[model samples]
Target: MLNNRYEILEQLGRGGFGETFLAIDTRMPSRRKCVIKQLKPDDTTNTAPTPGWFEKRFQREAAILEELGQNNRQIPQLYDYFSEGENFFLVQEWIEGITLSQKHQQEGNLSEAQVEKILRELLPVLDYIHGRGIIHRDIKPDNIILRASDGKPVLIDFGIFKEVNNINGGNKTVPLGTPGYMASEQAAGHPVPSSDLYSLGLTAIFLLTGKTPQALTSDPNTGEILWRKDAPHRPSNLAAVIDRAVRFHPRDRFTSAQEMLTGLPGSAGREKTSVVVPPDTKILPPSRFERWFWVIFIVITGGFSFGFGHPIIKPWLDYLFPNEPTVKELPLIEPSSQINSFVLDEDGQTLVGGDEKGNIYLWEVATGKQKKTIAGQGKAILEIAISNDQQILASSSEDGTIKVWDLKTGKERITLPNQRGLIALALSSDGNTLVTGGKDTTVKLWNLSTGNLIETLPVEKEVVSLAINQDASIIVSGHSGGDISFWQKQGSNPYEPRIFPSINPWTAPSVAVSADGTTAASSSCQENIRIWKDSDWKDSPLQAGSSADICLIVISEDGKIIAGRSSDETIRLWNLNTKKEIFSYSPSSPKSFDSPRMIALSGDGRTVASNFDKKIQVWRPSF
Candidate 1:
């Protein structure tokens, strides 16, 4: 028995400074099991080392562990800590599951999908700890417990965590952590946030290849591990991300856990890495025909430009393409902040835009006049939706709340608290039903009139986009996991949802469904826009001739036209029946085109609106 309440059952493991033991708490009626660690001061006869320093270090690390466990569920809770003479003890929540090392030994190597899933789950935990300005100097397979209760990975053994404030040139640097798992900088006694990521990358490689890092060979020139050859079946994107994470230098590794998470396979935002070329690879000059083609094309264009100039060529070009509609830039009375989200009325007569300054601007489309300006949520707006009657406006921002405003009065009507900020919103034609998809992995339906919670539909992943059909009978949602789900209302019971897996299952997809609920479109960073038709959901291709991924898609109410904005800062419209592009517009300034919802299309698809820099550009088809 130790600490007067904990009864030791068996020894778990031993470290350089401590020994862990399995124990039970007798104070509580439940008598829960916990892991107790006994810390001892180094008895070496070195003048530099002292018992006072060891005591302070243990207390500081124990306080950090308690704080981390209380905040995150993935970390083990610290029960108690105390000093008995010169020795110290810490009791922690015992996780009842196998370690990643033991799991690997029992089940062999993990698949690419399994490795990615683990990375996604653990990165958020890393982000949480990193946000507190602490670096976990040790991250390895043996330190991670696959919790049997929920199958979630629980991070453990923060024995060598260094608070950023405690790091300075005066403090003696001591390299600590398991061999082969520690990063180069960490091994050299300077570990940053990315050093944990480096260890994680090696752990992932070990899980995938079923080989220890010590067994893996390293490049003599670059010092990069050569483990990809053993896991050759892994996707190139995943390989590239791991390679970047395990770079030799601290700056060469991912800057943060969130950055590495975004670089994961299927994420919409991918990080660019240097291309590795083989020693024997050679670059050849352009072929004779290719060289001649480029030379003749440039010469002909230059000759025509020189001969006609602007004055003569402008009229001739207008005559040759008389049907091409000219894009009109809207004039603002005052300088406006960058617009992040906007919506157009059903008739395309009015435009409502939200800017980064948390202000909403209403405009008259025909005359380019500012109708009214309303102060919105005090955060960058992410999405906005207008009521079918154009009488009500709903906007969501980064502040995690939804504000409903009266279009005519420009006064706030109601504010609904949406937990974990919404990414997509859909309003029914009657304006009575509002459907929202959020980072909470749930789609919520709310009553717009009384601001009452209606229903909650559970989804497997975080939803990125949403659309509702006429009569509020059908709802379509796209998820971060590249899933498209259809929720159909049958006689007032809870909506029955049917999930349809997307072709690109790793990226978040943007979705748009027609008012009739017969046609739907979905697109992601890894794939082109795909149109799903019929009740069974047979999909067809809609080629926009753009290689960039489409981040936002809007379909006409009648399901005849669909418009999408690609990552290349181009907005395009296509006729659903003919599958032909009506018009493609690439704005000169891409300042406001950085994210989704910066572009809006009317239900008729005749008018398109997008923000370029501080100005809104509107376009109409010339027939």
Candidate 2:
């Protein structure tokens, strides 16, 4: 080599900042294979601000690598870093492995479980760097090496690589990371700990989709890459975690690497007792939404029968619905037996019913006779949602799976296997995304057409109830935390949740969003109802004052009216603008209300559907 202490064997690779060669230390008693890097483009007295910033920066990176290599096996050891004439050189341990990019090319797209295992392994490596007050700045598939002997990933090309290429090109020092892998903030000369997270998330997406970051489409307005629509079948849980990490804004990303790790599929709902995560180890636990998600699942499955409507769910239920509906009852259309869940088309013309025996029925509202029946289900169906065009019907059951059916042929289109079993779900207004809450205590967004997981929203609670706005711009969820929270979609920002006001901590709240997406309403177990438009309260809170607890809330598409039920075995209605009660229905009174498992409001805000036990009930309630 240059100094004669090493002998160059072959040229391995070359890049803008330097060239790498395979070499052996001839001076050593036992010759060992090592890597020799030749760094170039020296401008000691010219453009660089630090004057000799390149040399000093190179030395600093060597020290950092040396420390990391000694402590962690995933990093290559730095044996030497020196300057020869105008060129810089670093002799380091040669890692015999395949680059992730190479592996991706050889193996094609990896399975969700395979991608997840990579995340669980490499996130800790990033954590170790970030905790030491250093930012890797660049992370992509090409920069990671999969050791052939162990199959463990080894991180390469750290500090010095960034310092050479990341000049902000301004009066300030901005480090430019590789295109496609760069975080929005890093490009602006402000790289935070979350910056690396963005790159890492993008890398995982590339490995799973086999598409480079540039090939993915990004929303022109938010500048956030729309990878979910492209890789529709990727696991929803992992997608959700990646969505948070790669937000357009750094502040919206995970504050740290360890935080991102806890939200992935394997750790989201796991108990700490089962897996030991050391406090000093620097990895944080799951996000608040994730914890709330599990709690919701536990409370709904372990404590109540009909999810949001069960009176025993929270302390507030014990005192709610203090007085029975005082108005005359509305007209009733009844079903033959107890029904678990049902939906009414936009015109309230068609009724789709789900039963305990795993059968589905489509009935003509005018005739009250079953027009078509789709049979042979495996378990009791818990919830049902119809697409806006009335072309598809999605249903969830006790079997831990979700099925999408074509209305025209009454044939199944897609089947999603969810091991946690689904408890609550809603179809997006556009009918493309299906939002669901599962027994695993996770909230997920699915692409209906391809059965792809669009996002895994870790709400930290199981679902008491879930709702997404008509435009699919916002998601509001009621959790086992005994309150409803609002989640807004921002351009690549971390999901920040705000608590819905006018409710006590011990009350169980049921949330619903208007079809226009302009308004939302919540009916708490305390019999207290509040209305909201956008982010603020629109009207004074209304009370159902049921002689029993109020279980659920459903808002009309027009955002003008709402329908809810009480444990007093009655269905009640109210006008949002008038702030007054519309009417109440006691058609099946004297018989406990436990027979109706679910209820729905028509788009025109005039009709309501209730599944009484097994019988389907469609009624028109007048103000």
- Whose lDDT is greatest here? 1
Candidate 2 C-alpha lDDT tens digits along 512-601: 887656788777656567677874645346654542266778876556777887755467777776666656667644544455446777
By TM-score, the best candidate is: 1
Model 2: runs farther than 4 Å from truth? Answer: 1-337, 491-494, 501-507, 535-540, 543-548, 587-589, 612-614
For residues 1-623, what per-residue lDDT tens digits would candidate 1 score against the true structure? 89789999999988666789999999989999999888765545322121143454466577678989999999999999887886788899999999999989998888899889999999999998876646677899999999999999999887443321122211113446765677644544445677799889989998889877656666544446678888846668788889888875555677679888988978886667653322211221222333344335334654254332222222222222321112323333232677777888764667888888889998877557777899888888877888655778888888888988898788999999756756888887557788998788899998989999888999989888898876677888998878899888878677888888878768888888876677888887678888888567777678745624877788866677787777777888777877767567775553643343467887656567775556676765421
RMSD of each: 26.1, 27.3
Give the C-alpha miss distance for residue 101 in model 1, angstroms: 95
Q: Note the residue pairs that clash in candidate 1.
A: 266-506
